[model samples]
Target: MNSPWYIGDPSPSKDESLVYAHGTIMVISWMLLASTGILFARYGRHLRISGRRKLLGDTIWFQLHRFILCMVTVATLLGFFLILIKEKGQWVSVAKDGGHIFAHSVLGAIIVCCALLQAWLALFRCNTDSSFRQIFNWLHRSMGYLAFFLSIPTIFLIVTESKVLPMQQDGLIAILSLWSAWIVIVVILFEIVEYRDRLNSKMGIYRVAQNELMDQTTSLRRKMDHNDGANIRSLNEVKLFLFLLHIIVAISLTIPLVVIIWRQN
Candidate 1:
């Protein structure tokens, strides 16, 4: 086998076309992965959202999630291959200002591995009353979140590395970067708000229980249940908002790439 140092391009900054293709493909991949991951985690997992009016169900959402995961896997592979072919002998570039390519490559590999692991675990997931269901769900969900988070930095680095100015003579990479950053920030803030509300809901229930009179146990139970229901309602509402956010992000991310791809041809 060849040395580890000889696998990627040593001078990626010099290749404008390679940078354009790399940035474009990776950005498109991120858009799909982010949208799918958000949908599965926030909306698909909930009975309130997925089970309403039979609009979606566990199996339906699960299948859709898996299908999009497969797409993410394919997109990741394409991006990885593009980097390897274009950035020859640059893996682990040791200079102070270099080697980010190697970092990007390694990160992409990790996300791909996480996605595959999640998919494999999904195969064994079952509906029967088995003890493994909880473990399987936990593992699947954790990996999904991890992979999506990992992709965030990879997308950021790969896009920003390409200095192509939007509407400039060279390329439109800069605008794509802004769109990506905006979408990521919004989604992240939304998730933060969602989780904070969840924590408050749990804390509210705990406090209510703690402050209840020993003789008023039934009343306390009623209060707890009401709070829990309200919490669920708020979570579903957030999920609905997230779903809309996903649509906007997806459209914003895709339209530019599609237009550029068409223009490139």
Candidate 2:
């Protein structure tokens, strides 16, 4: 007599190793997908900062974004492929150990379709001035965000499921901890970028306040020199200050991600 699903064995028909491999691929693949959200959010900031400098053209950023999206597309497709063929015809039986596994599968399918649509948008992308460009950008961002949000729970369900627990040798608790930590890191990074942009905009007000405070100071012994050289030196000092601040911010923002990646090594 055949054994009952989820009770008898996690991998009755297929090799358990392949299932583990699939899980690993899924984790790495989702990382790529998550990056799309970060890049999309950062696109406007990059453009604003480099609008005049033109460190690189917008097209290059577009291409880079498309490249990552393509990788995500392929990875997601491969995931679906594994879902069907990697199970060795035991797809139905595999669901017996479900605790949102089916929900994860359904969300994965939806995300894949969303990814393909975004890819199609890129292929026929409109000019920046065109009316359709805004629509395309909005839809692209919406889909990307939706996919990212749904992916969290989906990943959690798949990674922490009882059947999949044995696959992660590092222990399920650690894996989930890393996932939660990564999400928090992503949010912190986004907030840092947004904060930087807002601060730059308000620097004018800050400068006025500083000048007022300097005017009120009675302890100044000498008259201030506003010569070209002094101005240049002051500008350079401000630039140096901002640059160091950014370096600190960048390091702080990336530490968690660095730790996670290093842990993987």
Measured by TM-score, the strongest candidate is: 2
TM for candidate 2 is 0.62
- Predicted candidate 2 versus true structure: per-residue lDDT over 1-265, tens digit per residue: 1322122253455344444445555566565444543454443333322223233554444544566677877777776677567545554433364645666667777877887887788789898899888898898788887876776677666545554443332454465566557566655655565565566547646755676776544333122323333443444344334434433543443344334322321
TM-score for each candidate, following the candidate numbering? 0.59, 0.62
Candidate lDDT (C-alpha), each: 0.61, 0.54
Q: Which stretches in model 2 have alpha-carbon errors above 4 Å?
A: 1-14, 40-60, 88-99, 167-170, 202-265
Point out the worst 10-residue segment of candidate 2 by lDDT.
1-10
Best by lDDT: 1
lDDT of 1 at 101: 49
- Scored by lDDT, model 1 comes in at 0.61
Candidate 2, residue 118: Cα displacement in angstroms equals 1.6
Model 2 clash number: 0
